[model samples]
Target: MDIRKLDDRLSVAPQITPAEVTEAAALGFRAIICNRPDGEAPGQPTFEEIERAAKAAGLEARLIPVASGGLPPTQAVAEMARALDELPGPVLAFCRSGTRSTILWALAQAGRRPAAQIVAAAREAGYDIAPLAPLLETAA
Candidate 1:
Protein backbone atom coordinates (compact mmCIF):
# COMPACT_ATOMS: atom_id res chain seq x y z
CA MET A 1 0.00 0.00 0.00
CA ASP A 2 1.25 3.51 -0.86
CA ILE A 3 0.24 4.96 2.49
CA ARG A 4 0.96 8.53 3.56
CA LYS A 5 0.97 9.07 7.27
CA LEU A 6 -0.83 12.37 7.92
CA ASP A 7 -0.27 12.23 11.64
CA ASP A 8 0.45 9.71 14.37
CA ARG A 9 -3.17 8.63 14.46
CA LEU A 10 -4.10 8.74 10.79
CA SER A 11 -2.90 8.00 7.26
CA VAL A 12 -4.38 8.54 3.83
CA ALA A 13 -3.88 6.56 0.66
CA PRO A 14 -5.40 5.89 -2.69
CA GLN A 15 -8.03 3.22 -3.06
CA ILE A 16 -7.00 -0.07 -1.49
CA THR A 17 -7.92 -3.50 -2.72
CA PRO A 18 -9.72 -5.91 -0.45
CA ALA A 19 -6.67 -8.11 -0.66
CA GLU A 20 -4.58 -5.25 0.65
CA VAL A 21 -6.52 -5.18 3.93
CA THR A 22 -4.32 -7.94 5.33
CA GLU A 23 -1.26 -6.01 4.35
CA ALA A 24 -2.64 -2.94 6.11
CA ALA A 25 -3.20 -4.97 9.23
CA ALA A 26 0.36 -6.20 8.94
CA LEU A 27 1.40 -2.55 8.84
CA GLY A 28 -0.30 -2.05 12.22
CA PHE A 29 -3.36 -0.06 11.18
CA ARG A 30 -6.21 -0.91 13.50
CA ALA A 31 -9.02 0.44 11.33
CA ILE A 32 -10.05 1.38 7.80
CA ILE A 33 -12.15 4.36 6.64
CA CYS A 34 -13.60 4.32 3.15
CA ASN A 35 -14.45 7.80 1.88
CA ARG A 36 -15.31 6.88 -1.64
CA PRO A 37 -18.86 5.88 -2.30
CA ASP A 38 -19.46 2.64 -4.07
CA GLY A 39 -19.51 2.95 -7.87
CA GLU A 40 -17.93 6.35 -7.95
CA ALA A 41 -15.75 4.87 -10.61
CA PRO A 42 -16.38 2.08 -13.02
CA GLY A 43 -13.96 -0.36 -11.47
CA GLN A 44 -13.81 0.87 -7.91
CA PRO A 45 -14.23 -1.86 -5.36
CA THR A 46 -17.42 -1.68 -3.32
CA PHE A 47 -17.12 -0.74 0.34
CA GLU A 48 -18.63 -4.09 1.25
CA GLU A 49 -15.75 -5.96 -0.32
CA ILE A 50 -13.22 -3.83 1.50
CA GLU A 51 -15.15 -4.09 4.75
CA ARG A 52 -15.12 -7.86 4.47
CA ALA A 53 -11.38 -7.81 3.99
CA ALA A 54 -10.89 -5.44 6.93
CA LYS A 55 -13.02 -7.64 9.17
CA ALA A 56 -11.06 -10.68 8.09
CA ALA A 57 -7.90 -8.86 9.06
CA GLY A 58 -9.45 -8.01 12.41
CA LEU A 59 -9.65 -4.32 11.61
CA GLU A 60 -12.65 -2.08 12.18
CA ALA A 61 -14.16 -0.28 9.16
CA ARG A 62 -16.30 2.82 8.67
CA LEU A 63 -17.73 4.45 5.57
CA ILE A 64 -18.39 8.15 5.21
CA PRO A 65 -18.44 8.67 1.49
CA VAL A 66 -18.20 12.01 -0.28
CA ALA A 67 -18.05 12.64 -3.99
CA SER A 68 -14.72 13.75 -5.45
CA GLY A 69 -13.87 17.33 -4.47
CA GLY A 70 -17.30 17.69 -2.95
CA LEU A 71 -17.42 19.67 0.23
CA PRO A 72 -17.82 17.29 3.12
CA PRO A 73 -21.07 17.87 4.95
CA THR A 74 -20.81 19.02 8.56
CA GLN A 75 -22.35 15.78 9.76
CA ALA A 76 -19.84 13.76 7.79
CA VAL A 77 -17.01 15.79 9.24
CA ALA A 78 -18.37 15.22 12.72
CA GLU A 79 -18.67 11.55 12.02
CA MET A 80 -15.08 11.39 10.79
CA ALA A 81 -13.92 13.00 13.99
CA ARG A 82 -15.95 10.55 15.99
CA ALA A 83 -14.47 7.65 14.07
CA LEU A 84 -11.00 8.89 14.77
CA ASP A 85 -11.74 9.05 18.46
CA GLU A 86 -13.69 5.81 18.64
CA LEU A 87 -11.51 3.64 16.44
CA PRO A 88 -8.10 2.47 17.47
CA GLY A 89 -5.09 4.56 16.73
CA PRO A 90 -3.33 4.65 13.35
CA VAL A 91 -6.37 4.45 11.14
CA LEU A 92 -6.21 4.46 7.36
CA ALA A 93 -8.62 6.43 5.16
CA PHE A 94 -8.81 6.18 1.39
CA CYS A 95 -10.48 7.68 -1.66
CA ARG A 96 -9.83 7.63 -5.40
CA SER A 97 -6.82 10.01 -5.23
CA GLY A 98 -6.44 10.17 -1.47
CA THR A 99 -7.15 13.89 -1.65
CA ARG A 100 -10.71 13.51 -0.46
CA SER A 101 -9.60 11.39 2.43
CA THR A 102 -7.11 14.04 3.42
CA ILE A 103 -9.73 16.74 3.07
CA LEU A 104 -12.12 14.89 5.29
CA TRP A 105 -9.42 14.40 7.87
CA ALA A 106 -8.68 18.11 7.80
CA LEU A 107 -12.34 18.96 8.24
CA ALA A 108 -12.58 16.58 11.15
CA GLN A 109 -9.75 18.43 12.85
CA ALA A 110 -11.10 21.89 12.04
CA GLY A 111 -11.69 23.44 15.44
CA ARG A 112 -9.28 21.19 17.28
CA ARG A 113 -6.24 22.10 15.16
CA PRO A 114 -5.06 25.35 13.69
CA ALA A 115 -5.55 25.81 9.97
CA ALA A 116 -1.84 26.06 9.35
CA GLN A 117 -1.17 22.91 11.27
CA ILE A 118 -3.82 20.98 9.40
CA VAL A 119 -2.85 22.40 6.01
CA ALA A 120 0.82 21.78 6.61
CA ALA A 121 0.15 18.22 7.65
CA ALA A 122 -1.89 17.59 4.52
CA ARG A 123 0.75 19.28 2.38
CA GLU A 124 3.46 17.06 3.80
CA ALA A 125 1.25 14.14 2.89
CA GLY A 126 1.06 15.47 -0.73
CA TYR A 127 -2.35 17.11 -0.49
CA ASP A 128 -3.11 20.85 -0.70
CA ILE A 129 -5.41 21.49 2.20
CA ALA A 130 -4.96 25.26 2.03
CA PRO A 131 -8.33 25.72 0.41
CA LEU A 132 -9.85 24.65 3.67
CA ALA A 133 -8.18 27.37 5.73
CA PRO A 134 -11.22 29.64 5.62
CA LEU A 135 -13.55 26.90 6.71
CA LEU A 136 -11.18 25.92 9.45
CA GLU A 137 -11.11 29.47 10.74
CA THR A 138 -14.87 29.59 10.79
CA ALA A 139 -14.99 26.28 12.56
CA ALA A 140 -12.49 27.48 15.13
Candidate 2:
Protein backbone atom coordinates (compact mmCIF):
# COMPACT_ATOMS: atom_id res chain seq x y z
CA MET A 1 0.00 0.00 0.00
CA ASP A 2 1.21 3.44 -0.89
CA ILE A 3 -0.07 5.16 2.22
CA ARG A 4 -0.55 8.91 2.10
CA LYS A 5 -0.58 10.71 5.39
CA LEU A 6 -3.28 13.33 5.57
CA ASP A 7 -2.05 14.61 8.89
CA ASP A 8 -0.51 13.36 12.08
CA ARG A 9 -3.58 11.38 13.00
CA LEU A 10 -4.67 10.01 9.62
CA SER A 11 -3.42 8.33 6.47
CA VAL A 12 -5.24 7.21 3.31
CA ALA A 13 -4.46 4.62 0.71
CA PRO A 14 -5.79 2.76 -2.27
CA GLN A 15 -7.43 -0.65 -1.90
CA ILE A 16 -5.34 -2.60 0.57
CA THR A 17 -4.92 -6.30 1.01
CA PRO A 18 -5.14 -8.26 4.24
CA ALA A 19 -1.37 -8.51 4.30
CA GLU A 20 -1.18 -4.75 4.29
CA VAL A 21 -3.03 -4.76 7.58
CA THR A 22 0.02 -6.32 9.17
CA GLU A 23 2.22 -3.72 7.58
CA ALA A 24 -0.08 -1.02 8.85
CA ALA A 25 0.00 -2.46 12.34
CA ALA A 26 3.76 -2.75 12.14
CA LEU A 27 3.86 0.87 11.06
CA GLY A 28 1.98 1.71 14.30
CA PHE A 29 -1.42 2.38 12.86
CA ARG A 30 -4.08 1.76 15.48
CA ALA A 31 -7.14 1.48 13.26
CA ILE A 32 -8.38 0.97 9.69
CA ILE A 33 -11.36 2.57 8.03
CA CYS A 34 -12.70 1.09 4.79
CA ASN A 35 -14.59 3.60 2.68
CA ARG A 36 -15.19 1.27 -0.21
CA PRO A 37 -18.35 -0.73 -0.11
CA ASP A 38 -18.37 -4.45 -0.71
CA GLY A 39 -18.78 -5.73 -4.25
CA GLU A 40 -18.31 -2.31 -5.68
CA ALA A 41 -16.20 -3.90 -8.33
CA PRO A 42 -15.04 -7.28 -9.47
CA GLY A 43 -12.11 -8.85 -7.61
CA GLN A 44 -12.23 -6.50 -4.64
CA PRO A 45 -11.78 -8.06 -1.26
CA THR A 46 -14.73 -7.74 1.04
CA PHE A 47 -14.47 -5.40 4.01
CA GLU A 48 -15.06 -8.33 6.34
CA GLU A 49 -11.92 -10.01 5.08
CA ILE A 50 -9.89 -6.90 5.79
CA GLU A 51 -11.61 -6.32 9.11
CA ARG A 52 -10.72 -9.82 10.23
CA ALA A 53 -7.12 -9.28 9.32
CA ALA A 54 -7.07 -5.92 11.06
CA LYS A 55 -8.59 -7.43 14.19
CA ALA A 56 -6.05 -10.22 14.20
CA ALA A 57 -3.37 -7.61 13.82
CA GLY A 58 -4.78 -5.83 16.87
CA LEU A 59 -6.16 -2.87 14.97
CA GLU A 60 -9.66 -1.48 15.28
CA ALA A 61 -11.53 -1.74 11.96
CA ARG A 62 -14.46 0.23 10.61
CA LEU A 63 -16.29 0.18 7.28
CA ILE A 64 -17.99 3.39 6.24
CA PRO A 65 -18.46 2.86 2.53
CA VAL A 66 -19.44 5.77 0.28
CA ALA A 67 -20.36 5.59 -3.37
CA SER A 68 -18.33 7.49 -5.91
CA GLY A 69 -19.70 10.95 -6.91
CA GLY A 70 -22.52 10.80 -4.39
CA LEU A 71 -22.60 13.07 -1.39
CA PRO A 72 -21.57 11.34 1.78
CA PRO A 73 -24.54 10.47 3.91
CA THR A 74 -24.89 12.53 7.08
CA GLN A 75 -24.72 9.38 9.14
CA ALA A 76 -21.57 8.28 7.36
CA VAL A 77 -19.83 11.59 8.07
CA ALA A 78 -20.93 11.46 11.71
CA GLU A 79 -19.72 7.90 11.96
CA MET A 80 -16.33 8.92 10.62
CA ALA A 81 -16.20 11.75 13.16
CA ARG A 82 -17.03 9.29 15.89
CA ALA A 83 -14.36 6.94 14.63
CA LEU A 84 -11.79 9.69 14.70
CA ASP A 85 -12.78 10.53 18.25
CA GLU A 86 -13.09 6.99 19.56
CA LEU A 87 -10.57 4.95 17.62
CA PRO A 88 -6.91 4.95 18.52
CA GLY A 89 -4.60 6.95 16.28
CA PRO A 90 -3.14 7.15 13.87
CA VAL A 91 -5.80 5.68 11.62
CA LEU A 92 -5.47 4.41 8.07
CA ALA A 93 -8.49 4.66 5.82
CA PHE A 94 -8.72 3.20 2.30
CA CYS A 95 -10.81 2.78 -0.81
CA ARG A 96 -10.38 2.50 -4.58
CA SER A 97 -7.81 5.12 -5.68
CA GLY A 98 -7.96 6.32 -2.04
CA THR A 99 -10.27 9.07 -3.24
CA ARG A 100 -13.29 8.02 -1.24
CA SER A 101 -11.22 7.68 1.87
CA THR A 102 -9.81 11.16 1.48
CA ILE A 103 -13.21 12.56 0.60
CA LEU A 104 -14.88 11.08 3.66
CA TRP A 105 -12.08 12.22 5.90
CA ALA A 106 -12.35 15.68 4.41
CA LEU A 107 -16.08 15.73 4.97
CA ALA A 108 -15.64 14.70 8.57
CA GLN A 109 -13.20 17.53 8.94
CA ALA A 110 -15.73 19.94 7.50
CA GLY A 111 -16.31 22.95 9.74
CA ARG A 112 -13.52 21.75 11.99
CA ARG A 113 -10.91 23.20 9.62
CA PRO A 114 -10.85 25.74 6.82
CA ALA A 115 -12.35 24.51 3.56
CA ALA A 116 -9.30 25.68 1.66
CA GLN A 117 -7.01 23.79 3.97
CA ILE A 118 -9.03 20.65 3.57
CA VAL A 119 -9.03 20.94 -0.20
CA ALA A 120 -5.33 21.62 -0.24
CA ALA A 121 -4.65 18.61 1.93
CA ALA A 122 -6.60 16.37 -0.41
CA ARG A 123 -4.87 17.88 -3.40
CA GLU A 124 -1.51 17.33 -1.77
CA ALA A 125 -2.53 13.74 -1.23
CA GLY A 126 -3.32 13.47 -5.00
CA TYR A 127 -7.05 13.92 -4.90
CA ASP A 128 -9.19 16.57 -6.55
CA ILE A 129 -11.47 18.00 -3.87
CA ALA A 130 -12.39 21.37 -5.29
CA PRO A 131 -15.85 19.93 -5.94
CA LEU A 132 -16.49 19.21 -2.30
CA ALA A 133 -16.62 22.90 -1.42
CA PRO A 134 -20.29 22.92 -0.47
CA LEU A 135 -19.96 19.95 1.80
CA LEU A 136 -16.79 21.31 3.30
CA GLU A 137 -18.70 24.40 4.33
CA THR A 138 -20.85 22.32 6.65
CA ALA A 139 -17.80 21.77 8.79
CA ALA A 140 -16.59 25.35 8.43
Give the CA lDDT, 0 to 100, for residue 76 in model 2. 90
lDDT of 2 by residue, 1-140 (tens): 79998888999999999999999999999999999999989999999999999999999999998887777788998998899989999999998988888888899898889998999888888889898987788668
State each model's C-alpha RMSD to the native.
0.8, 1.2
Runs in model 2 deviating more than 4 A are none
Q: How well is each residue in 76-132 modelled by candidate 1, as lDDT tens digits?
A: 888899999999978999999899889888988988989899999999999887878
Pairs clashing within candidate 2:
110-139, 111-139, 111-140
Number of clashing pairs, model 2?
A: 3
Per-candidate local distance difference test: 0.92, 0.91
Cα TM-score of candidate 2: 0.94
